[model samples]
Target: MSVIYGLLTISILVALVFLIVFIFSVKSGQYDDSYTPSVRMLFDDELVKDDSKKSSTQEQKQD
Candidate 1:
């Protein structure tokens, strides 16, 4: 019984420490996507096609 209580206490402390570290990391933007958005925008196929279609339709309308 005492061993179980000790184990439960240690597990809870370890979990709390992990949670605190995760929150700190998030607050510090350690997991923020600084590069993915810029790179994703550069390589996104749908956006590129949509932009080309819009301009082509505009040019056709002008003609």
Candidate 2:
């Protein structure tokens, strides 16, 4: 009854606060890197060194 109205108003206020914060951040440049984040997973940070090639050469020398 009365409690429900209070809870609803509090929730709405909280939601509005979050929306305002998000809007301010967007305007400030927090989300400027819109493209790199989406494509970051497609590229590797560093090339993986091929250890097998080195190990095979070492084995040939030892034999």
Candidate 3:
């Protein structure tokens, strides 16, 4: 019972710390760029590779 209580206390402290850090980060404009991350992820490397493979297959079939 005492161990569980201690764990609960520790978890509450950790949660508080994370909450403070998140608030500070939000105030610091860390979450300002709402569009760039979404757009950047949409243009990552795998799509380019998949597109090239598709085009190459299309060319081979045409040949």
Please give the CA lDDT of all the candidate structures.
0.96, 0.84, 0.95
lDDT of candidate 3 vs native?
0.95
Per-residue lDDT of model 2, residues 1-63, tens digit only: 999999999999999999999999999999898898778766544323346667788999999
Write the candidate numbers in order of decreasing TM-score.
Answer: 1, 2, 3
Residue 45 lDDT, candidate 3, scale 0-100:
82
In model 1, pairs of residues that clash are none
> What is the Cα root-mean-square deviation between model 3 and the actual structure?
5.9
What residue pairs clash in candidate 2, if any at all? none
Candidate 2 off by > 4 Å: 34-63
The top-ranked prediction according to TM-score is: 1
Clash count, predicted structure 3: 0
lDDT of 1 by residue, 1-63 (tens): 999999999999999999999999999999998888889977799888999999999999999
Clashing pairs in 3: none
Q: Which stretches of candidate 1 lie over 4 Å from their true place?
A: 44-46, 50-63
**Candidate 1 TM-score over all chains jointly:** 0.67
* Model 3 misplaced regions, further than 4 Å: 34-63
TM-score of 3: 0.53
